[model samples]
Target: MTSTLDDALKRLEMAVGLLEASVSRRLEAENRRGDLETELQLMQDDRARLAVELDSALTRLHRFEAATDDVSRRVRQAIGAVQSVLVQAGQLEPEEG
Candidate 1:
């Protein structure tokens, strides 16, 4: 009878130990899940901010392109005028093409 009781006690202790270990693992998993959720939120916020920045940069790029086109047109006109003046003064020949 004593041997049976000892065996039962040992089994009970082992079961309790296993239960504790399982609980610990579950808690750890929950903590990790919380951390992951926080990280995901941060990533989402960063993505939103980056998207806004990208849009602003694109808008600035378009504006710069328009300004560049305007400057290019003005430069071409000035070059043509200079060429005409040179041709009329007989300092340069008119282009054939």
Candidate 2:
């Protein structure tokens, strides 16, 4: 009877130890999950910010390209006017394609 009681107590202790180890593992997993979630949120926020910055850069680039095109057109028109005046003054011969 005494041996049976000791065996039962030992089994109970082993069971408690196993339970504690399982709970510890679960708590550690939960903590790691929380950390990963926070990091993922930060990454998502950074991605959004980068997307906005990229869009702004593209918009500015488009405006600059449009301005460059306008300048080029105006320069071409001025050159054509100068060529016409020179031709009328007999200072330059007419160009042939």
Candidate 3:
């Protein structure tokens, strides 16, 4: 009877130890998962912010391009007018091309 009681007590102690170890592992895994989730959220937020900045930069670039085109057109028109005036004044020859 004494030997049987001792064996049962040993088995119970081992079972409890195993249960505690399992709980500890589960808690550690949960903590690691939480940390990973937080990191993912931060990455997503950064991606969103960068996307907005990129869009803003692209919009600015397009506006600058449009302004540059308008300026070029105006310059060409001014040059044509000057050439016409010079030709009328007999100061410049018109090109045949």
Candidate 4:
């Protein structure tokens, strides 16, 4: 939907084309005709899979960081509250003569 996506698609297409050409040229040396279409399809599938995995990983990382920050904040607040209570209770306790 965005220009960035369009750019990425273009780059991927170019890379696929380059890969197909390279494989074909290399196979020609061995008297073999490689299936460029199949290779391209495989590459595309791999790219898609990696993209999905990356997105999932990034989402999880963000959630983990947010949860960590939330817990840290709560812990700091709890510690301060406990410290205050301890100080008050210490003052209230009668001292030995």
Candidate 5:
């Protein structure tokens, strides 16, 4: 009977140890999850800031490209008109330098 009681006590002690280990692991996991949530919030804020910057830069780039196109068109027209004038004056022969 004493041997049986000792065995039962030993089993109870092991069960208590297992329970304690399980609770510790659960607490650690909860702490890790909270830290991850904070990190995720920070990342979301950074993404929003970057998105605004990208949109502004794209708008500026588009404006610059439009201005460049306008200037190119004007330059081509001016060159065409100058060529016509030179031909009328016979000073710009296509056969000579």
Candidate 6:
């Protein structure tokens, strides 16, 4: 009877140790999951910010391209007018090449 009681007590102690170790492992996993979630949120925020900045830069580039095209058209018109005037004054000959 005494030997049986000692065996029971030892089994109980082993069970308690196993339970504690399991709980410790679960807590560590939870902490790691929380850290991963925080990092994911920060990455998402950075991606959103970068997307907005890229869109703004593209908008500015488009505006610059439009302005350059307009300037080029106006310059072409001015050059044509000058060439016509020079031809009328007999100061420039029409190119044969």
Candidate achieving the largest TM-score:
2
Worst 10 residues of 3 by lDDT: 88-97
Considering only N, C-alpha and C atoms within 3 Å, which residue pairs clash in candidate 5?
Answer: none
TM-scores for every candidate against the unseen true structure: 0.86, 0.87, 0.84, 0.57, 0.69, 0.81
Please give the CA lDDT of all the candidate structures: 1.00, 0.99, 0.99, 0.87, 0.95, 0.97
Question: Candidate 2 residues 1-97, lDDT tens each?
Answer: 9999999999999999999999999999999999999999999999999999999999999999999999999999999999999999999999996
Better of 4 and 6 by lDDT: 6
Write model 4 residue lDDT over 1-97, tens digit each, in one string.
6899999999999999999999998878655334666688899999999999999999999999999999999999997778778768884443355
RMSD of each: 1.6, 1.5, 1.7, 21.6, 4.0, 2.2
Total clashing pairs in model 3: 0
Task: Residues 37-88, candidate 1: write the lDDT tens digits.
Answer: 9999999999999999999999999999999999999999999999999999
Q: In candidate 3, which residue pairs clash? A: none
What is the descending TM-score order? Answer: 2, 1, 3, 6, 5, 4
Checking candidate 6 for backbone clashes, the offending pairs are none
Residue 76 Cα positional deviation in candidate 4, in Å, after optimal superposition: 0.4
Model 4 score (lDDT): 0.87
Residue-wise C-alpha lDDT for candidate 5, range 1-97, written one tens digit per residue: 9999999999999999999999999999999999999999999999999999999999999999999999999999998788878888997765344
TM-score, cand. 5 vs. native: 0.69
Candidate 5's C-alpha runs over 4 A off are 1-15, 93-97
Q: Write the per-residue lDDT of candidate 3 for residues 1-97, one digit (tens) a residue.
A: 9999999999999999999999999999999999999999999999999999999999999999999999999999999999999999999999688
Worst 10 residues of 5 by lDDT: 88-97
For 49-77, candidate 6 gives per-residue lDDT tens digits of: 99999999999999999999999999999
Which candidate order results from sorting by lDDT in descending order?
Answer: 1, 2, 3, 6, 5, 4
